[model samples]
Target: MKTVLVIEDDIGIQKQLKWSLTDYELVFAQDRSSALTQLRRYEPDVVTLDLGLPPDPANASEGLACLNDILSLQPECKVIVITGNTDNEHALKAIALGAYDYYQKPVDADVLNIIIARAFKISDLEAENRALKSANVGNTDIIGNSESILKAYRTVEKIAPTEITTLLLGESGTGKEVFARAIHRQSPRVNKPFVAINCASIPENLLESELFGYEKGAFTGANKTTLGKIECANGGTLLLDEIGDMPLSLQAKMLRFLQERVIERVGGRQELEVDVRVICATHRNLAEMVAEQSFREDLYYRISEITLNIPSLRQRGHDIVIIGKALLHKFNQEFNTQVQGFTDSAMQSMLHYAWPGNIRELQNKLKSAVILADSKYITEEDLGLSARNAKVDTLRKVREVAETQAIRHAYTLATGNLSKTADSLGITRPTLYALIDKYRLHDLRNTETEN
Candidate 1:
């Protein structure tokens, strides 16, 4: 049986909870000392914490200290804090400090049970996704099954066989590197070394040497002869991440490399030919950079034989739930917790929220949620989105401000039949009727409908 550590000072409340969660091995610790002892001995996956411990029951310092100690010992432990009715602000602060879910007193087992279940599910999902315990570790595996991701997969499949220089465009944290790796994985050069270099990270002076490699004595601290990423990727592929920030001089050199398939090592006279496929990616708008003369237009034209745009998480339907489930599983294994899964509300929030930081942010937030969540299902609150005001306002369509191209999607998918377009949206046929009337799309529909 799983263990639950209850940290409330009230004896009556403790007895009630111990009876409520009798299925689990129940342990009680009213103060910091007993709590630490029970925590060390039992190592409970979920803790029902009362933020009013003795030595300062009226103040939150003792309880907060206990919370920190639990986290420090087992950062993945699920700690559901107990707070006052109007102490929601403190609960939010506790969440920010990595508390899973906080409850408002007086304590009610039914409500607390719900929170605990959600926490368990979240913990389970996270445990399922983590690869191993190590620093700088990443889940290099491509992690989406949405139509948008499927489209990306298809694009990679189509371009992988060819030697064309492909440009991947997307917002940061949208898994540009993952897509780049996917392309390499499916390419002809899979057996060869796949080298990746961040073009924008290295200094301009050092960037050249990092890519083209430097000959010994090429520059200060150029201690020994070294092969650059491009040469190292010979007969393979090189992913130029953040390619938009590369210097124009380097862009010119890169264009030459693409054309000649040869690179001159920095400060070296060797003109070595390489058989490496080039894949470039950036979150920046290259067209804007080109117009500003911050980037080489000619180089952009050369490298962009094919372009793949990765969709953001918000655009990927149902993928949020998929990735969340995957993440919950990862944390479950990592922390050895029994977190169940996401609550319906949590799932809805994941679907509706605009993921500004994309997958990376999802992992971090879920990691905290899984360890802190106390229930079998992770509620929206457990995911740090419980505030009623935090609920998202739905994305509304504004035809008046929309582009002709935007409405064209509705029209095309509707098969250019205005009547069908209105039916799909569940609005009154006349409401769709009015939109078609106002948008001047009726004429275009008739012409296309006839065809």
Candidate 2:
């Protein structure tokens, strides 16, 4: 059954509300302090507050204070305010201060019941939506249909349930962090905290304390002991973003935690054990960094128990169109625009132009286009994209470039083998040779000559 907290000071109205709101498991509080206590204790789904309480029953100040406190404690709770029939200003003030809805005094139990019912319905819908979002983390959130991206998602699906330390490797703005979250949601620790810390973003002097935490007096301003990201994520997952940029001095401490599953707080003697699954992500090549001795080889090996390489947006064919359309719809709602979709020219430019900043760049461009677009559809100019370089605009030229690109990619994968290239492209050897000749792919000829 849904819970409702009624905060009213008047005895007659409180009794009437109790009798009327029999549908809900109701809890009552007379004033601000008691209302907050009941709010924390019951954590009710809905709250009906009287905008007149003790010490200032004639005014709305005390009631408004209680409303703020209630929301601060439980932001999701729907607060409905009860105000005087003439108290239009206070009713408006209550709505502005985050009251879900308002009811004018001289209680009509039937009318108030309708409002409460609607509030509960809305709250239930929101809760269901949150659940759907959490459940769809594995499937719906990571949007891509290309072969390369499919392979990456497949890797995530396989490795997410395991306890192994997984490393996500990709270019900046690629969905490495998204995959990390997908892993966490799919894991047993979904209910536990998933703490993320970016090594590159934090100052070197503070990164250690942020990761491993510090005891009181660890530093000049340290007034109280604090739990670090790793400790906070105990029994869950901890994402070490930009792991390659982590300071060398802190790498040893991280290595110790990984090896021992334990951490020592700064200025503390006791070692605290943590059971967090470490997931590291970085755009930099850890192998090369290890070779150059800039990154610790042992730490690299420890974190890379399994490595999943997320493909760049440009590499994922047709996914650019898919993600662009999705972002367009999202931004349409966000910006309150009625933009239908991207223009044909816009789609062409998006396909042809290299998205160097990946999904982040695509999102920002779409958001700008939606906000600035005066027409029903978003144009390439609105998105700030240059004209599709002659290739994409002309169908024949596009096919030619696409065919040659496919042949080149397949040839490399097939190690310049004629039969293998033909099979990979699903073409006969003669057709492969014809296309290779048509494109003047002299690299294949050179490879054959060398062989």
Best by lDDT: 2
Q: What is the lDDT of candidate 1?
A: 0.81
lDDT of 2 by residue, 295-343 (tens): 9999999999999999999898778877887777678788788987777
Q: What's the residue-level lDDT of 26 in candidate 2?
A: 83
Clashes of each: 39, 0
Q: Kindly state the number of residue pairs that clash in model 2.
A: 0
lDDT for 190 (candidate 2):
88
Model 1 TM-score?
Answer: 0.57
Give every collision pair in model 2. Answer: none
TM-score per candidate: 0.57, 0.59
